[model samples]
Target: MAQAGGRIRIGISGWTYAPWRGVFYPKGLRRKDELSYAARQVTSIEINGTFYGQQKPQNFAAWGAAVPEDFVFSVKAPRFLTHIRRLREVETPLANFLAGGLLSLGPKLGPILWQLPPSFRFDAEGMARFLDLLPQDTEEAARLARRHDDRLKGRAVLETDACRPLRHAIEIRHESFRDIRFVDMLRARGVALVCADTVSWPRLMDATADFMYCRLHGSEELYASGYNDAALDDWARRCRAWASGREPGDAERVGPRGARVPRDVYVYFDNDLKVRAPADARSLMGRLKLLAADGTPRR
Candidate 1:
């Protein structure tokens, strides 16, 4: 069996279904059922909207109850944390989101992704100041790089201290994040890079992190129209290969963090680019499972 941290644990960004972009997987499935089905097929999910704002505590609690044990959720911290507040406010929404039974997801809660906007460029002085505002690790950096960073070292600590403390994963949309120095800086500080696959430009394809984090935006030119089965299947295969310890034939060596081991990959489908995230996730999951069954090369 493919384990959470071991295999290509696939998932979608949001739970809502979009039929506009040819996504109809959730037509028959109820909301809870949709979540349950996704849990059976995929191992993880990256909650997208949590960063935009907070959700009802009861809703989060209900979500925790819908999925199976061992399923993980890679949630995005609210925009209040990364965009608007910039790690300033730590009382109302953030606190509520973390302490309101989110742990019910259990080991299912992977990392809370803090996706910075394009304006949030990588400035060593600024980032260093920001990092200094966060927490620190108990052991040395080397020993801790391979593991999770303690939330008490910087702004991350402030967030964690408030109750919604979870693993921190970051995705930078701006081109500035492509720089080697910037990427390594993130790894050095124990921040995971998000490998965003968009039609425009692919950022940090060869970057290293404790785990793999991917978002399949769209195909070559139809980025806004959504993804076809073919594109999804292709992504699924790549994810499997990464997880199975089989690098792509043309795979280039990216920078290494701590050890040189390949980072774990997590794939997410965006809601805007695609009509139905859950359906697309299911189709992608089916293809991955089929590939697993055939023991075929993930290409």
Candidate 2:
């Protein structure tokens, strides 16, 4: 569907405490009114805490009622699915754990993030068996781990029918998934790569799918301290470009210093330092609105 005002959809991570403009907004302002305020301006959010455990169905229902229908929520699947199982032998406990909370997320749920632990590096045999074990309920995610081994031989596995459009994005923290060949492996399998922008790990910012997923930890400036107004404003400009496809006339020559131009980007701030995530997100959303007024770049 077409986006609002030809602008890209924008969202922050989970609602966390930030002074004035943290990830979602300031903690002091996180009352029902504040959440509603932020929700009106942004498009979606990644529910991060779900990784720890499932929430009660009442909680999910309340959340669903809170956000607008257009709003989408991407939830991190609990550790049981990604970290604990790691495609090893399936256990009833694991299945029960996933089913417990995921089923409660209801329809507003967008994607179930299967973020593998950093220690669990690429392993074909282990990953293949893991892939086979993933529950049919959760949809879409990349198997970046298994692509590394030439010893592995098989077509890219796809279970679109089982989960329908539910898909996964491979989060390649290590350099191993950096290779285009590896990314191509995911693309062929229909796994959208998770585009993460951090001072440490920057994935290739390419259009891997029509629906983009991004988690922006921080730039070199705020990488350590979390995001500030300036940092968020910069990102908002890029988001405008991604959503609308409009870029500055001198974009090619502008380099990094020019007046902010939209880059094809979707981001969620992870820099939770000093409760800055929400405040930064609010600031970022304001700048993006300004950019949208100027021009929107869409793909």
Q: Which of the numbered candidates is closest to the native, going by highest TM-score? A: 1
| Native-referenced Cα lDDT, model 1 | 0.57
Model 2, which residues run further than 4 Å from truth? 1-7, 18-38, 90-94, 101-107, 128-164, 221-265, 290-299
TM-score of each: 0.70, 0.65
lDDT of each: 0.57, 0.52
For candidate 1, lDDT tens digit of each residue in 112-150? 677777677667666655554333321222222223233
Q: Give candidate 1 regions above 4 Å deviation.
A: 1-5, 18-33, 87-97, 129-166, 200-202, 221-223, 226-234, 244-258, 271-276, 290-299
Q: Per-residue alpha-carbon lDDT of model 2 for 1-299, expressed as tens digits?
A: 14433335456667643443533354456465555665555666777777787455455656767877766677776676667776465444344434333434455566556676666666655555544554434442222212323322232222222343554555656655555555444544545467676766544544443344667766664433566666566565555555554442322210122112232234566656555555555456556553244332211
RMSD of each: 7.3, 9.4
| Native-structure RMSD, model 2 | 9.4
Backbone N/Cα/C clashes per model: 21, 32
